[model samples]
Target: MRQDKNDHTNYSEVAQLRQQIESEYRAACEGLHGLAMRARHDFIQARMQRVEEYYQELSSIVGPEAAITTVIKINDAFAGTQRKQEPQP
Candidate 1:
């Protein structure tokens, strides 16, 4: 049916948008971490606000569980990056 096709198209578009938002969320988290490391307090606060906004938007699109999972993944990835940057004793 035409309506079915339209629904599929809409779903595909939404999925694409969700992917874009997830990418942005990951980047934002990394940026926030970098700002903290550099002691940029004002920029860190602004970036933190942006990160929270991204989380809320992600939650609205994919529900709380999926959003939290994404956050966990991002945090784990960031942690790995942090370890790589640390000076070895």
Candidate 2:
């Protein structure tokens, strides 16, 4: 049916938007870490604001549980990378 086709298209669009937002959120977090390490307080605050906005947008699209899951996954990945880069004893 035509309605079924439209529904599928809408679902696809939502999926794409969710993915784009998630990627932006990941990039913002990565940049925020660098800013914090460099002691760029002003830039870090601004970046943190942007990161919160990204979370709100993602939550609107995918619900809070899914949005938080995405955040947790990204954070875990970053933590793992940081651990690997730390100097060994």
Candidate 3:
């Protein structure tokens, strides 16, 4: 490709601007990641609490086998959601 000869563009200024924008983007990404982590933690904690309550209730109604199955289902649901939220290549 033939380059332009009269290209007197201020590349240094552009480079500085790019660096500033990239730094801001990185900081925003970090903040988002922290928020996501907290949200995921809270969701899992609430889920586990509900599961414990359900397990107790179901155990009394049905049996230990049913309780185990319910627990497995709860785990599978969380795993599926986490997988969906993960980044794809």
Candidate 4:
């Protein structure tokens, strides 16, 4: 099977990034951004469900919190992509 360019060759790198992000998230004590957090958590759950059905290998790589952050990033990236795809008026 052909590997995608985004596929992880080192799971450890993913784990390490997750750890770092979790540290930053925990250190955030501003007590704001709750709506964003909720949206991220919801997206993460949906993402994990799809991953379980599609990419079984990566299904276990993310926990709830990590998955949430990842989902947020994914959404942001997708939105940017969509914006780029639109024709400028």
Candidate 5:
């Protein structure tokens, strides 16, 4: 029934990071209303498929090809963060 002190702290940090990612994604998606429906659908499907890739795909909902690339960077950065957190062999 006991958790390590560092475990609780690490869990909190991970929760905060997730909140930041979602908030930033929402802010980025605000300019993407017209694309929302298709995005919502794609998001669901993507979630059903690969959860990790969801953020990048959601970021790209903005139809403009150029903007999509720029937006995807946000997701990419977070993705990289997760990758770096993994232990290397």
Candidate 6:
């Protein structure tokens, strides 16, 4: 099977980034920006659910231990930078 290019090779890093996002979410809300931030957080979370599903499938082949070792690069995902190219007008 072909390997996915975006797959992460460091699971620990992904865990760290996940922690950071969670901590920020747990902090007291700051108002308007906070509300928008919450929305963005929710969006990322739903995306994470999908990632989790993919991991589950991977675990079947590689075993959970290996699967968790690293998958899904977390840096750009946390930065909210993943996006499809849009045609310029």
Query: Which candidate's TM-score is highest?
Result: 2
Model 2, range 1-89, lDDT digits (tens) per residue?
A: 99999778757755665566556545555664554456456655765566567667767767888877876676677667767766799
Model 4: which residue pairs collide? none
- What is the descending TM-score order? 2, 1, 3, 6, 5, 4
lDDT scores of the candidates, listed in order: 0.64, 0.64, 0.50, 0.47, 0.49, 0.47
Q: Residue-wise lDDT of candidate 4 within 54-87, one digit each (tens)? A: 2223235655566666646644655565467567
Q: RMSD for all candidates, in order, please.
A: 4.1, 3.7, 23.2, 13.2, 15.4, 12.5
The whole-model C-alpha lDDT of candidate 3 against the native structure comes to 0.50
Count of steric clashes across candidates, in order: 0, 0, 0, 0, 0, 1
lDDT of 6 by residue, 7-82 (tens): 4433444455445443333331221134454555555565556566656665665678865654533434433431
Candidate 3: count of backbone clashes, pairs at least 3 residues apart or interchain: 0
Position 80, candidate 1: lDDT: 79
Candidate 3, poorest ten consecutive residues by summed lDDT? 1-10
TM-score for each predicted model, relative to the true structure? 0.59, 0.60, 0.45, 0.34, 0.36, 0.37
In candidate 5, what residue range of length 10 has the lowest lDDT sum?
A: 28-37
Query: What TM-score does model 4 achieve against the real structure?
Result: 0.34
- Ranking of models by lDDT: 2, 1, 3, 5, 6, 4
Q: Give the Å shift of residue 67 in candidate 4.
A: 1.1
lDDT of 1 by residue, 1-89 (tens): 99999778756754664566546555555555554446456654665566567667667767789776876676577667767876799
Per-residue lDDT of 80 in model 4:
64
Model 6: weakest 10-residue lDDT segment is 24-33
User: For model 2, where is the 10-residue window of minimal lDDT?
Assistant: 31-40
lDDT of 1: 0.64
Please provide, for model 3 over 1-89, each residue's C-alpha lDDT reduced to its tens digit, 9 standing for 90 to 100: 13343232334433443344334333433334545554455454554555566566556545678656755654565456556777999
